[model samples]
Target: MTTSTERAGSGLDDGPLTIGGRDFESRLIVGTGKYPDNETMVEAIRASGSEMVTVAVRRVDLDRSSEEGILHHLDPDEFFLLANTAGCYTAEDAVRYARLARAAGFNEWIKLEVIGDEKTLLPDVQATLEAARILVDEGFKVMAYTNDDLVAALRLEDAGCVSVMPLASPIGSGLGLVNPYYIREIKDRLEVPVIVDAGVGTASDACATMEQGVDGVLMNTAIAAADEPVSMARAMRLGVQAGRLAYLAGRMPRREIAVPSSPVGGMLD
Candidate 1:
């Protein structure tokens, strides 16, 4: 049996291992939150071709733990399980939850998000940075979920996070990149990988983020809420490829005049 220990960084290394020794194959990470059902979520995952999926770790209901429908639906081996401390309010709480997740079946890869404010769903940078630093020191590969604040992003990167996952818009807003330039700047300045984490509405939004040189995109609402999730998933896959290809291909400069090649007057003559 291929245990999580043996496969620690196996599939993840298909692409780049950004930080803290965790690797990822595809540049896209899909979140398992906000989907309509288990089947649809599974379909979306298959369509997206995403190797990593985010799973939130809350207090498992002691009474109904065995009957938790959603938990059972997820196949641990199919996707790289990135357990997140979504409901945590403090650094200590987040760290404890991460430990708990590790104790459970989930791996050491954690999406460290400490959001005390429910309205904005924005991360508490102070607490987030503290938690991230501690998590990194404790040997967990921290993928810090943060706001689009470049300063905070840099702080998280400096704190030894595996990757900085900044929100494209507010969580579940689906408004796409409110300020793409900031994300672009982060990609430009930071040494570690930057993944656009939330609020992307369509495939174009994902492409836009990738075009800005972001290492990857993490989306939930955009695909989950789509009228046809499978179709959306396919779109996202193509969009990611298009964006990556464009980035690598490099665009040509704008020209004021067209240079004629095959004898401009030959056709008329």
Candidate 2:
């Protein structure tokens, strides 16, 4: 497969939109998980040019000698921390963790996640929607992660979420997109920003989602788990830009017959 650089020319696409009153330069959001170390995560985030990065919150381990050191590596001023309620099982639990994030001085930007199953890592749609509604009403900019279910996505939007991030596949599967038609349909019906989160394996997958006209992408394992995390992050950035540009540029119509631009028999006639 051709690299994004080979497929798309060299240039930066237009910057991000001011969603929920936050000014993000790049539309590609990254997660700070599964990297080899904190330093590598920082490097990957830098290469990705992602202004918003996700961080998960769980019960504090009192036995550990030192703190978990998850967000300590990241410079808070430079990165907008999107704290996630990943381990929460119910809407109330997720809401409590979200409140904790706010108390920790990380603003109200949150990735609301309520897990229903451990095996599949699928979110509880009812719990997620409940948490999203509660968060939005409480003045938080909620970005709910859910299975690639169109009705669930619409429900989140109807609950007043600023953005709805539907998973392309299972969390951490690196499967790219399993059901793209649903994603396209969700994007068409929802007025809020639609982000393709989770299950993105390569930069091409990111580009494909953008080409489908989604507002943004939230990728994690694809970058953090890659052999060269930094390079993969950079590739994802370019791929996203290329995809967005292609969408805006308007694709050419497909034809049954090839149309030659060069004239035939012009020299010896």
Candidate 3:
């Protein structure tokens, strides 16, 4: 019998993840938040091996001294900065932030997030859809962050979003795939990339998301809040790669009856 480990090595080079006409080999998309310091953030990001990093537009001070701002630490050549409309509660606010991000020289890519409640931080589906539609029509490549509602996800896709990002749980909750069924359903129905945006606590959470055949994951608190952010980042990177490999390799089915690993007939009683 071929073991799962033996099969995992093949077909790893599945090809690049293309979003909004850009191709990236790294499927892990990280966030710039909740870090101890800027130096640590840079090191952790480097260790994560993520090609894209999400930045909260409202949090950035564009006019601040170069040495004091987050943008100074992130080299554009090393990573693709995905400016997100985090903390925006309304469609207009989200849209305004996207424009500000673009004017700051981040370009057309935007991660659209419109929070409905302060407690759960769950996305406001109606406001999210409204913002997404407007952004898409305005020529911005929008990656919408929405709840794990299949209908909402479909509507976002219809609104011309380049990718649909569903939450595993509430943002920063670290609940880890609260509704896998919904995520799977979204993936099955949508043609665009389906990325799990929030609620990943550790490496295993990320691994599980990738095994669901998601194109990628966007996490912040997971790595930033870890005891060792750099080490955790590396773990997440490996977990994502391993999970992707396992998914492509196909897992063995489980059986009710006991099955011996060695040859059953040849074994001595």
Q: Compare the candidates by TM-score and give the number of the best one.
A: 3
Residue 49 error for model 3, in Å?
0.4
How far out, in Å, is residue 70 in model 3?
1.0
How many residue pairs in model 3 have overlapping backbones? 0
Off by over 4 Å in 2: 1-15, 254-269
- Which candidate leads the pack in lDDT? 3
- Which ranking of candidates, highest lDDT first? 3, 2, 1
What is the per-residue lDDT of model 2 for residues 1-269, given as tens digits with 9 covering 90 to 100?
65777445533345565667677778899999889988899999999999999988766788884546676688988988899998899999999999988788868888989999999899999999999989999999999999888999999999988889998888899988888899989989998889888888999998888888888899999999999999999999998887887877767888999988788657684
CA shift of 195, model 3, Å: 0.7
Candidate 2 vs candidate 3, lDDT winner? 3
- CA RMSD, predictions in order: 6.6, 4.5, 3.0
User: Candidate 2's error at 19, in angstroms?
Assistant: 1.8
Lowest-scoring 10 consecutive residues by lDDT in candidate 1?
5-14
Superposed Cα deviation of residue 137, candidate 2 (Å): 2.0
lDDT of 2: 0.87
